[model samples]
Target chain A: MHTLALIFPYAVAFTVPLLAASLGGLFSERSGVVNIGLEGLMVSGSFTCAVVASRMETVLGPGNPGALWMGLGAAVVVGALFSLLHAFASISLKANQVISGTAINMIAGSLTVFLARTMTGSGNVRIVLGFIPSDIPVLSGIPILGPLFFTKTYATTWLMAAVLAVAWFVIYKTPFGLRLRACGEHPQTADAAGINVYRMRYIAVVLSGALAGLAGGIILVTYSGEFNGNVAGLGFLALAALIFGQWKPLGILGATAFFGFAATIANVSQVIPQFSRIPGLLLKAFPYVVTLIALVLFSKSSQAPRASGEPFDQGKR
Target chain B: MSRFKNLFTALAAVVLGLLAGAVFMALSGSNPLAGFYYLFRGGLMNMERIGNTLASATTLVFTGLAVAFSFKTGLFNIGASGQMLMGGLTATAIGLSVQMPRMILLPLIVLAAAAAGALWAAIPGFLKAKFNVHEVVATIMMNWIAYWTVYYTIPAYFKGTFLETESRRIPALASFRVEWLTNIFRGSYINMGVFLALTAVIVIAIILEKTTLGFELKAVGFNRYAAEYAGIHVPKNIVLSMSISGILAGLAGATYYLGYAVNMQIGVVPSAGIDGIAVALLGANSPWGVLASSLFFGILHSGKGFMNAMTKVPPEIGDTIIAIIIYFAATGVLFTRLWERITRKWNKEA
Candidate 1:
């Protein structure tokens, strides 16, 4: 019961960011553009949100919801703008998607560090507008699970879940979603059918940027309560979750939960006597190892979108 | 005309990236010219700095070759970081334990590091070849595992004291110090490692340009189905390419430890391996091109401290510059193709 209590909060916390990134990924991959720069986009978003929130506190005082929303908006804008680099390279210039994605990652990683060092006068920045839990009278009264899962859940978690539902509807039950999937599976066929493959890819990549940005914002505002160099690698882990989930919306949510559970175990194990001797680094690395095993086991049978990484050339195709 | 247009496009992309970087510097209230001055002067002002840059570049050359080698076989080996880490740890272990003569100890330790790197990379390679897994995903996941394993193993098994997390100092017998060349380089860190890196480049170049293995790898990359029909074992070539690439990356780690970081333990988290990707990309994954690119990155990296001292700009500016260079390099091919198309359309209209 004690372990379960400790595990639940982290699982909920992990879901917020995971769903955002996976949805962002879904948007891109569904439209025939593979967004590998999801990690970088998240980093840029997280940093921007943290810095803006911090600055806003100094100007507007501590408890400003307006400032927080503005910070979130800033993150979305920055993420989308930076994603244009990937869009230009992969969609317009027809470069290797992986290389372009990795380039974005490098740019995001370095730029954030550089900006943080300059603006904060230090390598790390603390989050200021901390999200306090709002309790509904009846829901907050429930026993252990209430506080663990719902009562303490941040606004972002609820928002992400809502977004996931909308994403599912958009992806499977809408005309836009059909066109996006058509673009991914066969851009040439989609082009012949009058869908603008390039335009769809651009929109998908930009939307991916925004969601990844929101994931970054949620991490800084809700989970870490700070921004630092540490979050750079988490984006990559999210990428792992996307692949492990086999590119499905709900599947990615489950994969993220699993990873989150692993993280919580590593964190909670510190208090338990039986697992105290295990090095924290090894435990921290558990999700990555699991991801490796999952990829090896599932990749043989897993199928990616047909035109996933390939740039669509109208003339050639 | 199209070739000329393509060249101009590539040049323009590089210029635009640098211009954007310069704007960033201006926004940060630093003089771009001053920063460039410090970058160049600090890198080449003294023999010692030059040697340091050369030494750093030597390792990057091998790692770049590693990345480029796998790329030729149509694989993206993001596991270079993990492979390099494993190699460094293995080399350090051998360097401390071996008591043989210098000639024997040097080769033995180097070989051990290479073998360890190859073994580390082989896991992803084997998985990819056997299961048809995407190398990018597998290699990246392996990188994280390698990072954790090295982080834990070093501290648990090799720490000298509670405060220090590094292993014991490596024995002098196993060290690959070239005292005479050090004098010629004006007491810089340059040593036999540079020669070894050059040799590796030459050997790789020969294999890629002149050997059957190279042809097999290229054929697999060109089209796996066709290669299979042509009697080439695509899976075997993929595995072999990654293994060889891993070995090269391992050699880089060993050389760095043996030549410059002697007696010092590597940091709990590694940086050199990650930086190699930037070098490899900037070099366009060409052997000779890698040599120049690695040296350029090395100079930029080593000169950062000097730049900070001379100018108020932080050392991280160097990283920003390298990141910009990589971004441009990654998209250079794309910009070139775009330029070619535009020019051809314009010419036809004319």
Candidate 2:
């Protein structure tokens, strides 16, 4: 019981970025674009967030609360802008989406480190402040659930949870969501029905970019508090969550939470008695191994949007 | 001829990549011309630097070939990095523990590395063939698994006295770095690995172009259904193609760990694995083309640090340039149209 409370906040903190990124992936894959570049987009966002937060520190003074929010906003904008390169190659040039995404990953990985080195004399930008966890006013008074969920929670955790709820509502209940699904399912049919397939896809990819960037920002402002050139494959893990969740909002929420808990436990296991019995290697490899198994299990009945990786052609049958 | 056209496209991509790199340099407030000058000179101004360029190209040559080989069978072997780690680990273990003559020991190390890499990749191949899982995701998972395995195994079994992050330096007899080869390169890190890479290139070229297996793999790549209709076993071919691809990457690991550097580091996923994708792309997935592109990339990589020291340009500019080239290569169709327009206009003017 004590361990649960102690582990809860850390797990939620880890899950937020992944949830945001997986949700971002959900949007792109739902709209017929396979966004393998989420990792790169997140890195770009993280770099932008770190730079903005660190720069804001000088102007607004250290520990100014508003700086982090501003940083998250900048990350979103930069991520959207950077994703345009992928959008152009995959959508306009009709290049292979996987190849374009790989290029994006390489570009983001190297360019951010290159620029960061130039800016900070090292390829890392450390911010003076990060989001502090706080208890919800009345919610903290609840029983077991409150202690685990509300007593020590990050603002971003609630923000992401809210985003997930909204995503579910929008995806299932809205006209826009219906059209988006139609475009992904049958872009030609959508075009025949007078829906603009290209426009819908562009919007979806860009939204994914923005959300992925926000995920990067969330990582920075939460536990990380610094921008290293790499996000240590969290974006890829989020991608795995996207697969594990079967492209559903609630499904992703569960998947990310599972991964988050696994990661958090692996990280703190040496100090904790219960987890120490497991080999460190097994703990580290657990999430990835599980994801691979999940992939195999889900391959036959894959819920992947039919046209997710296909380049939409209006003339195609 | 199509060969001429392919060469032209690759050259055009290279130019565009350099221009993009220049744009980045200008954005960062550095002189692009000075950067390029120093970069090329840094790679070629001395004998040792030239040797270093070849040494750098060695691992890339193997990895690029690995990617190219898998690509020939319509498989994306992004797991080359993981395979390299497994191979490197195996080679390192053998190098440290074995007692034998250099000639016999080196071949054994290479064979072990190759087997390890092949086994690692065969799992993904088996899964892909059996269950229809995406190789990209499967290979990625394999990469992380290999990463953790190495992370734990090295420290537990073969820790250096000084650093937990790296294995002990490989003994001279087990290394690819022959004294004669080192002296020939004027004390650069160049080794017998260069000869191995070249020999592998020739051998792979023959296997790909001359063998019945090559025909089957290419047939599957072009149209798997058609190949199956013609009595080829698609799953078996897929597995075989991936295993062969893994062999090259494993050899790359042996060269990288046992040849390029004396010791293996624990945490790093080799950038050469990713760079191999770039090499294969620019080379048009041809073995000879991979050799050419890897060499060019080697120059850029070897020159990058010197350029950084000589000018304000960061070493990452080389990687940025390679990435830009890949992006351009991915958009090859766009370039072909643009090129066609320019040529048509020139013909009209003529």
Candidate 3:
């Protein structure tokens, strides 16, 4: 019981970013645009959040919680703006989606490092804004569930859960969801039925960028408290989770939980007596190895949107 | 002329990429002209610089070929980094443990690297062929496996005297830098790897252009269904192409770790692996084209340090500039489409 209580918070914390990023992937892939740029988008978002939060901390005073929120907002906006480059290259110019995504990664990787060097004299941007965990009074009073759910919980955890719920509802229960999925499965048919395939794809990609950016902000405030030029392949891990999830919202939650738990185990291995003796590199490599195995097992039945990587052309019969 | 349209499109992308970098430099309060001036001069000003550029380009040439060869067979070999690592590790292990004369040892090292790389790539290839797993995901996963493998193995088996993250330096006798080549290049690290790379180029060119096997691979690339209908073994060809691609990448690893750098560094897949993608794109997926474009990229890379020292532009800025160029260069399809659109509009107007 105590072990569960100890491990749950950190797992949830790790899961949030993967959840956000995978959800972002869902939005784009379901709208017929394959977005391998999620990692780059997250980098842009993380850098933006760190830069904004750091500056905001200096000006608005660290006492204000609004500074973190503002930083998150700026990250989302910048992420969306940066994604326009990918959108334009992949959609408007009809470049290979994979190549365009790779370009975004290269640009983001170098641009952020460049900016960090110029502005901060280093590749890292440390932030003053850190989230504090608070106990919800009534929930904290419960028996086993109390500590697991309420005590010493960051507000962002609840926010992420809420966002997850909202995302699921929007994707599964809404008319827009129907149209977005239609665009992915059959863009030509959707086009004939008066759905604007290109517009839907653009919106989906932009939303992906926004959410990925927000994930970056969440990661900075919750986990690292600093922004380096790289996100340490967390974006790619989210992508692995997306594949493991089979492109479904609830499945994504399950997959991210599994990965997050694996990641948590790696992070807390030193504290756990049983896991402490293992070499750290093997532990570090544990999640990725699991991802590969999971992919090999789960990817066979993955029902990816049919037209996901294709360029929409109305004249193509 | 029509067959050369891809070349023109790639050139246009290069020019536009350079222009965009210039704009970025101006916005960053640096002289773009001065930056480029030093960049070129740095790559070519002296024999030492020229040797270094060739040494650098040798890895790119092999990696670029690896990418281009796979591209010909309609596969994206993003696992070149992993393959390179495996190859390098194989050579490094053999170089360290085995005591042999230079004649037998070096050839043995290159062959071992190729075999290791081929085996490493064949796993993903086999998976892709059998399970229909996307190569990108599989290859990326292989990269991390290779990364962690190197990370663990290097420290455990061949830890350096001071650095925990790197292997011990290779003995001079086992290295590719022959005394004659060193003399010719005036103490530059120009090595036998360059000759090996050139031989690979000619051999691959022959294999791709003059062989029935190449014909079959090309058919598979054009359309797997059509090729299957024509009695070609699609899965076998896929595995074969990827293995050959991996062989090139492995040779690159041997050259890079055994020749250019004396020791193996842990926790990094070489940048040349990913850059190979852009190289293949800009080179129009041709063998000779890869060699040429790799040399050009080598110039940019070798010149970056000098450019940083001479100009106000920071090294990070130079890196950003290269990234921008890679971005543009890799999106050659965009330029092709733009060209098509322009031509259509011109025809309509005329």
Q: Which candidate number would show the highest DockQ if scored against the true structure?
A: 2
Clashes of each: 0, 0, 0
What are the interface RMSDs of all the models?
Answer: 1.9, 0.8, 1.9
* Candidate 3: regions farther than 4 A off: A279-281, B337-350
For candidate 1 chain B, the 10 contiguous residues with the lowest summed lDDT are: B263-272
- Worst ten in a row by lDDT for model 2 chain B: B1-10
* Clash pairs detected, candidate 3: none
Task: Please give me the DockQ of candidate 3 compared with the native complex.
Answer: 0.61
Docking class of 2: high
Best by TM-score: 2
* Candidates' RMSD to native: 2.9, 1.4, 2.2
lDDT of 1 by residue, A156-207 (tens): 7788888999988888899999999999999999999999999999999999
How does each model score on TM-score? 0.93, 0.98, 0.95
What does the lDDT come to for candidate 3? 0.85
TM-scores of chain A in all candidate models: 0.93, 0.98, 0.96
Per-model DockQ against the true two-chain complex: 0.60, 0.85, 0.61
lDDT of 3 by residue, A189-285 (tens): 9999999888888999999999899888889888889998778777877887788888899989998999888878878989988789998778877
Cα lDDT, all candidates: 0.80, 0.91, 0.85
Docking class for candidate 1: medium
